[model samples]
Target: MSNKIKLTVLGLLITLNSLKAQQTSNKSYDVCIYGATSAGVVAAYTAAKYGKSVLLIEPGKHVGGMSSGGLGLTDIGNKYAISGIALDFYRRVGQHYGQFEQWIFEPHVAEDIFHTYLEKAKVPVLYQHRITAVKKQGNVITEILLESTGPRSVGRVKAKMFIDCSYEGDVMARAGVSYVVGREANTAYGETFNGVQLTNGHQLPDGIDPYKVKGDAKSGLLWGITKGQLAEKGSGDNKVQAYNFRICLSNDPKNRIPITKPAHYQPERYELLIRQMEKRTWKSLQDVFIWSRMPNQKTDINNRNGFSTDMIGMNWDYPDADYRKRQEIWSAHTDYTKGLLYFVGHDPRIPEHIRAEMNEWGYPKDEYMDNENWTHQLYVREARRMKGALVMTQHHCEGREMVQDGIGMAAYTMDSHNCERLVVNGMVKNEGNVEEGGFGPYPIAYRAITPKETEAANLLVPVCLSATHIAYGSIRMEPVFMVLGQSAALAAVKAIDGKSAVQEVDVAALQRQLKENPLADGSAPDVLIDNSDSFRVKVSGKWSVQKRGGYGPDYFLSDGHTDSSSFIRYYPDPNIKGRYEIYTYYAKLPERKAVTAVKVFDGKRLQEVVIKDEEVKVVGQTSGEWVKLGDYIFSGNGKPYVEITGNGEKVAADAVLLVAASK
Candidate 1:
């Protein structure tokens, strides 16, 4: 049958099935989610768990956006920031590997986990439903119209609340919610790394010629170099960070598809890479790409260095482009990436050692089996950021500004890929490559995810929350997106119960629910006392707070080389006096820095325990784990405490967990 006729038949079949399934024709739900991404699925699951009817609509066939797409080597800066459903997701993935949590995983494993969530939520997903328009009535989203794939089934989905979990904030934009694309000027948000940045000297090592012909300006620039004048430092413009495919390649020959010359391949397109390789002798093909190892001998290939996988300056029009134009951009990116890979592995002019190493990797035959074994989701690093109630800025990221109503925490560095490659001082340079990271995990405000009270009060945007360009870069990790997704869903439920708009929902109630019923179930969350919880963790002597690789927000590092007085004490503060299972977190410690003395006070006596490095094990990508510190009783007074005393060796303090002896 013709494609159009097939769609027509499919639509008729759907209508007939709906009529049979129920007598009344109903197209309404309590919650309407417009993306089946990692965030989208989590949001739908959360809404359904709250006893609300949820309709999850995906623009494509896949469910778990980039998390299951291929960015399997998670970009998590700190595990302590992850909470509730997001933490549960990692634990579920970990169970597959016979562990507690797994960050680096195969693409198929992540997708299977998402499918389990959908099945548990009892939410029916409408696949290939592209947003055509959003209908709103007086600042409230009444319904959204979508055109499904195969056939033009443009239909309306009415909902009490809407959550835009899509990477591109199409629903938010269509609902008249304000949003902005591209980097903001430093002055706009008072950020240090907001605008046109050239901090990293010409991306290509000095003397890499930009012209088509060596040293001939009249010959014109080669591929990938955009023709433009470099913008002044910290100035704003309509430029977005480069996007690429976080390809998953496998080395197992039995399950690998050989790297072949893809259609529309152009060898000359990678002339810059050839020139870059020539400037500095590369040891292996691995050095050219940010190839992080995954389970089952697979790899998550990311853009790294100059002239790698990131198709620079190619996706600037994506955030505002229509569906067809976006597809064209996606196809161009795919062609460029495929052509680059084929050229690197097959080009005889390249080093034999590099080609040999690259030959060992190819598309995994077991993954994306439905789509020619290739992932369909593009690694859209950043796109449209909703200009919501509060715009997160550098001040918040650096811990200089704190959010009183935080819904989630983001700890990754303020990172951005090269926004646009440029010709600078006669050498090809990359701009907007900023990787500033030093501050600890900062809370993402609830206001950051909600639409402004003036526009679409019922809509919540979690993936594309309110933030400046630099702030979004830090907050734009898959795990963090999942965190915000759960929080957004809870806020939606609370708004429905209160008969209020999303912005007017009680922030305190939402925060309390996030803590008391973290997983959206009545089950209680463990009482946590992280080092970042300054009010609960008391410290003495000199303690250095280090970011990254900690259990919670950040960890404390200190040594008694000068004085043995340094100590970090945690107060569990169990609401009632009772026996609780205690555990202390251990971050990846420095060499010869493992031994530490821990003391727990049970209101009667002080019990001491010594920690050994080899005793604790690592799980997933996080370099930290929780070790039991024994159960103890608190007196209901402030007498009970857990302290890691700084001894002769280096001491590290992360977090303390108090679990009620009962489940």
Candidate 2:
């Protein structure tokens, strides 16, 4: 046997012997987390930081899954959502870029940071330990079976609680928990953006078809285009979101690695892309949306325009694929993407301009040098979603509904890429291709992360929660996953202390903990309109209005004060009850305007309102004068009032505030 294999076997033998000896004794841990995913690492570190003995088991040789892998460009929706240890990771990354090390995308930098954190927390992470089975007792999980690859032996771990931090939900799956793989029907949850999108967004140019041949009736439809099948609209499909390698590329001639032809490079495989290029339908890589981290020597090249790096409409089988099958899928994806680059750079089929431009780009030698300088991880956008205690849908994100059991907050817009399949309505299209802007951040319910009672009692799935495809689009971000991971660890600790199942844990208590130890990342702009503020309210139509009053009688607006000399007064028309609508046409301003606040009053109190300013301006266009920035409605908690205010008396209102009955 080879020396590496010999060492691996010896390591496994030692591990097995140690585990067997410990089994005879009473060596138990407070918490155990399977999978050394980014979230898993955070879970273990956070739990250990909180004084919990954590046994972190990583099946793969690598610790940080996608984070330290290829996904160097972080997908943080709202930076504020990142708090706790998650923010600590970024802060540490920021620190590395201080004066000497300008580039922070180096794999060693990230790995070193994670190692230092684990060392600091005194958390023990065992690599090459795959969790094969989970043994449960009554309402609690007793022991988990971990198979070692080095010695090829099995070891068992007994812990008070378990966290299925693996992206595949390995522990939860092995425990026989109820989960889902593909898109759900719109009718199942009355959702609009769940399965099989076919609409073109603002990014994709118009009149461009997604079909293979331009209405070729003789040869029939082209390859890669899924059409002619009898399919219902807005119905569920056996499809999942796309996944890709977070390629860390460098342009520094010294460290840059040029595109290489794979051993299995097939010219025929790139026929479609070549055809698209010939048709002038392909979007160049350099032209793709570039989000720079510390100015343009480096950038996070995301899937932008029509045909970027997002291998959509082909990843429908990932959420439910087995291990071996997942590997095959990964290999196929890597070949396709890497081959695409090779073809673009050297293939004769590619256009001259595109080839010349592609030649100028190469891999970043400064990053991920261990694996021949290639990114170690693929960015799996969506995977197996757990059917937990509560499900988060688009309505929750759209402010149509509110989650009372909020353990954490999601401050990102509902974002998803195009899942195009074929041509429709005489045009090439894809569904779930929405990029609607202007919606404010909303709260993510804690219940969405908890598993069902029948599932593993101690298991908490924060990354892959019970959310629809559209909803997961917003929550699948890395920072959000880290925030939820911290919250999950906190919940695990509380559940262990209470000696109750994960589902049985009090959500109110969880919410309390989160608020008490909120992420100290940043602060929200201090902007609230109370009774102290005065106003010059304007009105139009059959309704009446006031400036500095609230929802009251003669005041014509809700009565509240924000600051001294600055109060708002609102009054609802007796003729209108239930639901009332208002419009603000225009406003004049005072001076000290730091931010803007719009409050709605409901006789007794202030209701949900929106606040805006330069720091938090609403982008893009809107339907009405009011863009409906935030629903701001909360259940079981009432601040029912209506008023708009700024720091100084200087405020501008363009539209009139109209209140009509709810229809």
Candidate 3:
């Protein structure tokens, strides 16, 4: 056996031993979490920091879910939406790459960072443990029975508070919490793009036929095509969005494996792809799959236009299915994805250039060694969303309605994968794809995570929070989930101390805790002043506010001139007298200034310095960055600010950061 295999066995043995030890003791915990995903890990770490014993259980062996799986090309709508532990996770990843902040990284690197959190917090994790049943007193979950495959791993865990962090919300469903499976009608929540959308995204061209033989009514429909008539545009249904693997592949010859035919491979399952490909003048695989680049020559390839990796209409049974049935669906997705990849590269009907280009990529040898170098986590985009206290609707995302008691913010687009592939007007087409963005970050209400007062009192659902189907699409992202998880942990601690239900916890106190103690350890937070802060910012002349490639919510672009008439200044308030290191954000724009100069004010003196652009640049995938100018001492009563000196060519003013010297 190889050394990697030995290490894999040794790790499993260690986890089994830990589970056995904890089960024999039959000890209760202060907080118990189901699903050790990215959100669950953060929740457990936060609870441990608050001096609570946390038991994190997972149905699988590994952690970090899709964050470590393959969705490394982060879906960050704006950097302004991330903060606290969620921001810290990305910063830690940035540190690994020797930069200020990194939005993308490797799989093993992400998983290792998650392990670091567990080790530092001393949180016990039980692998392969699924909730069999729940024992409750009144509305509170007293204990839960586990069905583990490992020896002596099946036991009950008693806890004061329980958090359901799984993507499917299994624990929340098993506890009899109210939830919904699929999309709701547009009229149900005043949403424009919620149910049964037949938009022009990831759709097939108009002439492709659905039958096995062209122009034959007797021939049956091709494989993977849904058998249903088109529904009304705004009608509701129980159908679910597609789910697939975010396959990680590499181009490095020394660290790659061939894309061989997988087990139970069926070539006919991808018949629609072949028919779709023959019609279009496809150049290469890039037109078929998005070739998003990651660090170390790896790619976070995902579904693209027309026919791709998404197994549409095959995941409808996943949200509410049992363990055995879910596993079957999971295996089917795995086989279908692998089959799609292999068939594209080997089938003769495909274009020669496409097959040649697809052959250059394979599984990364150094990642996911425990699962044959394939990601074990499937991208379940939207599942069973909880019907909690206050459901967030599209009005909230559109800024028409706002919530003051927000625990976190979400900034991604209202994105949904195609739900089904059908023949519309006798032509093969895909439906239920939605992608809408161009709004600012909206606050996620605190009540969204808590269940109804009558359903269950002590449970918090972070991953599957309460929201309308279309609204949930915008709020469901990994970073947003992590932020919600940390907030859930804080609320759990507050509920335990107050001896009250989750819904009854003080919202004002919880928000104070989040802002004052972001890391949950009383560490002082760095002062930040963005261009969006109109209260602390003074702008002059015709500076246009542009987003797309700017820092925070938006950045100010000079009116195509280097003059004082179009300049911006940021006033930083540290709230306490101290020596601080200040930095300015440099946005990536079309115009580049050769020598961009910035003026820093320190109570009594104003100093100008050219930005050290070479000293601070994002290593791999990010566009915007932070450049440190210098440190200054500030008086408690003085107003210190940074002004972008419009001396060079065109310039962009984004945001400023003030870090204490003590940090």
| Backbone clashes under 3 angstroms, per model | 2, 84, 0
Give per-residue CA lDDT, model 2, range 1-663, as digits (tens). 543564455456436534543443246888888877778878887788677888777776566777677556665443434556675676577567652112235554666676676667767666667776788876568888877765444378888888887777777777777788777888999988776555556234445444445556455554455674425767787676666666656556665678889767876655545444544544555554343332224434456545556676677676667667877888877776777678778977666786887776677655554455566676777778888878898888777898887766665556667555465665444455655433445678877887777666788888878888778887777667777887888888888889888787887887766555543222221122212234433332222234321211112221222243343444333233344445432222222244456666544455555444443322111111232333232232333444555333344332323322221
Worst 10 residues of 3 by lDDT: 614-623
Candidate 2 lDDT for residue 376: 61
TM-scores, all models, native as reference: 0.90, 0.72, 0.95
Ranking by lDDT: 3, 1, 2
Q: Per-residue lDDT tens digits of candidate 1, residues 60-109?
A: 86789999999888888888788988888987887799865678899888
TM-score for candidate 2, please give it: 0.72
Local accuracy of candidate 3 as per-residue lDDT tens digits, 1-663: 563985576487556636653764378888999998899999999999999988888888788989999988887777778888988899889889886578888888888898888878888888877888988888989998888865546578889999999999988988999999999999898888899999889988888989988889589898878889999997899999899888899989988899998999989888888777777778877888887888899988889987898998999999999888999999999999998889988989888888888899898888888788899799999889999989998888878899988999987788888998898999998989999887888899988999998889999999999998888888988889999999999999999999999999999999988988888877778788988799989987667788666666688877666566556889876355778888888876666676677888887789997875454455434447778878888886667789986553577888998877765
Global CA lDDT of candidate 3, please?
A: 0.85
Candidate 1 local accuracy as lDDT?
0.85
* Best-matching candidate per lDDT: 3
